[model samples]
Target: MLMAKTAIITGSSCIGRESAIALSKAGWNVVLTARRADALKETSLLCESLENCLVLPGDVTDEEFVKRLFNETVVKFGRVDLLFNNAGVNAPAIPLEELSLEAFQNVISVNLVGPFLCAREAVKIFKNQTPVGGRIINNGSLSAHTPRPMSTPYTASKHAITGLSKCLNLDGRAFDITCTQIDIGNAATSLTARMEKGVLQPDGRRMPESTFDVTHVGSAVVHIASLPPDVVVPQFTIMTAKAPFAGRG
Candidate 1:
C-alpha cells in the first residue's frame, strides 16, 4: 500500500491551524508544531482525521528542537513530503529608532532563523529519502515587497525570507527540492485584527484596511502543495482586493 503523503506545519494558530486542517481534509498526514502545547493540541483536534494529525509542540528557533521535530515526524509518519515553514513573530509597531534591540532580534529569531533551521532539516530528509526530493513553502508577507510604517523588524525579516526562498530554489534544483514563498497581505486572523480598527499608514495616517478570509490562504497552500514535483511556483501573492498593497506607500 502506498503511504499517505505527510506535511509538517509550524505555527499552531491562525494560518498554520487552518492549513493543517485543510491538508488533513485532503488526506495528508500532518505534524503540527509551535511553542504552546495546548494550542497545538487545539489545532490537532480540529483536523479532519485526528488519527493522522500529530501535535509536536516546541520552539522552532532552537536548532536541536527543529532537528527533533523532523526526526519525530519521520519516525511517526514514515516520511515528510512537505514542510510549511510558517512560524513567525512581529515586534511592537513602534518607530525603528525606538524599537529595542531585543525586540528586533526576537523577530529575526522566530521569523527568519526558525524557518532556516526547519528547511535545513527538511532538505536533509528530502535529499536522503527514497524520493530524493520534497517541497518547502515559506509564509512571507506583503511587507516583503513594500513596508508599512513602524514595521521595521517584521518587514526586514520578511524581505530576508524572499532571498532565502530564492536561494533554496537555486540550490535545491540538484535534488528536486522546490521552495515557494507565499506573500500574504491583510489576511483576517488574530494577528490582523488590528487592521479592523486602524493601522498606521505610510503618510502617518491611521486607516482601516480591508482583509480577506484566512481560509483562502489555507486553500492556496493546499493547491500549491498538491502540485506535481516538477511544477513549481516560486512566489505567490494573495491579498484582499481592496487592500492597499497595490500602492502601499
Candidate 2:
C-alpha cells in the first residue's frame, strides 16, 4: 500500500479550515496549525479521516513554534509533501498616517514573517528528506495586485508574498521543490462579514462587494495540491465573478 501524502496547513479558520477538510476528504494526511487551539481542534474534527489529521496550535510568527510544527509533522507523518503557507493577518483599514505602527508591525509579522519562517523550515526538510523535494502553496490576496483604499499594511504584506513565492520557485528548481501562490478575492468568511454591509472602495465610496463561497477556495487548494510533480502553477487567482475587481477603483 502507498503511504498517504502529508500536508501542513497554517491558519485554522475559514480558508485554512476549509482547505483542511477538503484535503482530508481527498485522502491527504493534514496537519493544522494556528494560534487558537480550540479552532484548530474544531477544524480537525471536521476532517474526513480524523486519525490522519493532527492539530498543532501556536503562533506562526514565533520561530521556535514554527520549528516545532515541522518537527512534529515529521514525527507523526514520516515526511511532509506540502506546506500551505496560509496564516495571515490584516491591520485595520485606515489611512497610512492614521495606521498605528504597532498594527502595521503586527500585520507584517504574521502575514510576511510567519510565512518566511515556515517556508525556511519546509525547504530544509524538503532538501534533506529522501524524496528531495516538496511544494509550498502561498495564500496571497488580490490586494497584491491592486491596493484598496486604506489597506497599506495588508497590501504591502501580500505584495511581499508574491516576491517570496517567486524566489522560492526559482531557488527550489534544483531540489524539484515548487512554490505557487493563490490570490483570493472576497470570500464569504467571518473576516469578510463586514463586506455584506459595505467596504471602502478606491473611489471614496463604501460599496457592498460580492463574495463567493469559501468552499471554492478549499477545492482550489486541493486541486493545486493534487497536481503532478512535473507540473507547476506559478500563480492562480480565484475570485467572485461579480466582484468589483476588474474595474476596481
lDDT of 2 by residue, 67-102 (tens): 999999999999999999999988877678888989
In model 1, the Cα lDDT at residue 101 comes to: 94
Give the Cα-based TM-score of candidate 2 against the true structure: 0.98
- Report model 1's TM-score to 2 decimal places: 0.98
lDDT of 2 at 44: 91
Off by over 4 Å in 2: none
Model 1 lDDT at residue 242 = 90
Per-residue lDDT for 145-231 in model 1, tens only? 998878989999999999999999999999989999998988899988988899888787888888999999999999999998888
Task: For each candidate, give its TM-score against the true structure.
Answer: 0.98, 0.98
lDDT of each: 0.92, 0.92
Count of steric clashes across candidates, in order: 0, 1
